[model samples]
Target chain A: MANGSTLLVGIAQGIQRPSALQRMLPSATRRVLNVQLTELEHHGLVSKTIFAELPPRVEYELTDLGRSLLPVIEVMEQWGNTHRTALEQALAGNLAELPN
Target chain B: MANGSTLLVGIAQGIQRPSALQRMLPSATRRVLNVQLTELEHHGLVSKTIFAELPPRVEYELTDLGRSLLPVIEVMEQWGNTHRTALEQALAGNLAELPN
Candidate 1:
């Protein structure tokens, strides 16, 4: 899910990378994120620059456009955390109503 | 996509319904939205009450929890509209770089 990766990157910037994503996301998803990062760089949403080393190293940072999305992601995080119980209850209720 | 439908309902609460969703979304999706609205009612994210009519009628309204999500969806809408060009460019560039 490219869209999922996009949203994840938007959430990951300036935050610790979640262990769940690292452990649970497929290798193909990691590759997709790499590609998306490159595209985001090309579109000025993120930046990639080389650093001095025997082998070149790079860092990914959000550009201004990318930074603008932080508020949106924060809102999503807040919503997820606050509504988590409600969501759980809803999910449970749905399951309970399911036919055997 | 239940999540997609949830997001769409969040977007549609205060705004007029978009024709694209009405027409392009599958009937199954519409049914899902109806179910979600009912669940949302149970969770107090939305409210539904009977209205006076020969055949029962109901109108949906967001409760406090639901209203809280509007800002998040607005941010997403803004991001989508503002980045539409970049997204298009990224998609087009990806296509152009594809091997023949």
Candidate 2:
């Protein structure tokens, strides 16, 4: 949740074309997603493929390295879900409500 | 890796007293580590305990949720080590020589 990159990488866990990704994360600007994709690509976590057609089609998918990150991300997501209440209390700056 | 919290969580995988953690991450300031520890505690991923002793010692350990994150963090560490070359090239801003 801290880094936008994880969200992008999570969405790209499965092979997806650019347009689909854009639609999936409508709130994110194309530029932001593009930057994350580039970073992931550079890190060898994601790969990009361009299809030759009337208009070039681009698809993004996780590499072995990228796929390796899913288990971690999944755990993070699970933790976030399981502890949503505590996290919300913390975020609200209500320290007193937190359990010991 | 982007968020300092992950690094902190990774370090907290095993029970560690503050002094031990400080030794493990010598470069990090005490304030920074404290902030991260607070965040993790708030999120319910970590728990803290105080011992009634001559020095009033304190210890920090991962909760079940925190321990659950180990598998994911392991994968991330593995991925980083495996793809160190591509990541380094990207960081160095050398676009060429990157495998396709």
Candidate 3:
């Protein structure tokens, strides 16, 4: 769920359409989103529903299992935001200290 | 914190020594453990102390941040245990249904 957390969390927040998810995760490739969605579906964390229309539409929603993961992911997201700078500096420092 | 969670949680459970952590995470390589430990250290999730002995002994202890991550990881671990079979079956089924 590392790479997939952003997608999953966005879906949990009611953004189900792929376009919306793509907008939210600009760095994510279509293939990557597909693969993450497939993994989430496989893990029972999310469900995919296809709508029959002039153009087919696909939407994703969190299953109960997926909902359960949200709080953890939320907490992790908060932690990441809170410590992102420190983590960046630490890694930079570590890299700088590495032997030539 | 995904891969590092195992090591962090193990340390939170009073398993501090590297050798002991390695024992707990048998599948983890020493390099992986070192990287995780360094990241955790950088994140302020854990701290390392070295004992000057016949051979230097290293130990890790969780910071408040690291301790906070434990509950989330514990919940995730429980969910994984609970849904292991369903998840495995789902993936296998998905794979089986794929076109040749």
Task: Please report the candidate that would top DockQ against the real structure.
Answer: 3
Per-residue CA lDDT of model 1 for A1-100, tens digit only, reads 3454444464454432333333434564666656655566556566566778877665566656767666666777778888988767766876777788
Q: Candidate 3 at B19: error in angstroms?
A: 1.7
- Grade the docking of candidate 1: acceptable
DockQ of 2: 0.39
lDDT of each: 0.59, 0.67, 0.81
Which tens-of-lDDT digit does each residue in B1-100 have in candidate 3?
4568788878878999989888877777988878778878866778899999979999899977677778767867877787778778878877787899
lDDT, candidate 2, B12-80, per-residue tens = 656368777776667778887787777777666677899999999988878666666666666667767
What is the clash count of model 2?
Answer: 1
Q: For every model in order, what is the number of clashing pairs? A: 0, 1, 0
**Model 3, CA-based lDDT:** 0.81
What would the per-residue lDDT of candidate 2 be over residues A15-43, giving only the tens digit for each residue?
37766677667777888778767776766
Query: Ten consecutive residues with minimal summed lDDT in candidate 1 chain B?
Result: B15-24
Residue by residue across B51-72, what tens digits does model 1's lDDT show?
7887766555666677776667
Please identify model 2 stretches exceeding 4 Å from their true place.
A1-15, A50-57, A67-100, B1-15, B50-57, B79-100
| Candidate closest to the true structure, highest lDDT | 3
lDDT of 2 at B41: 76
lDDT of 1 at A96: 79
Q: Looking only at chain A, give the TM-score of model 1 against the true structure.
A: 0.59
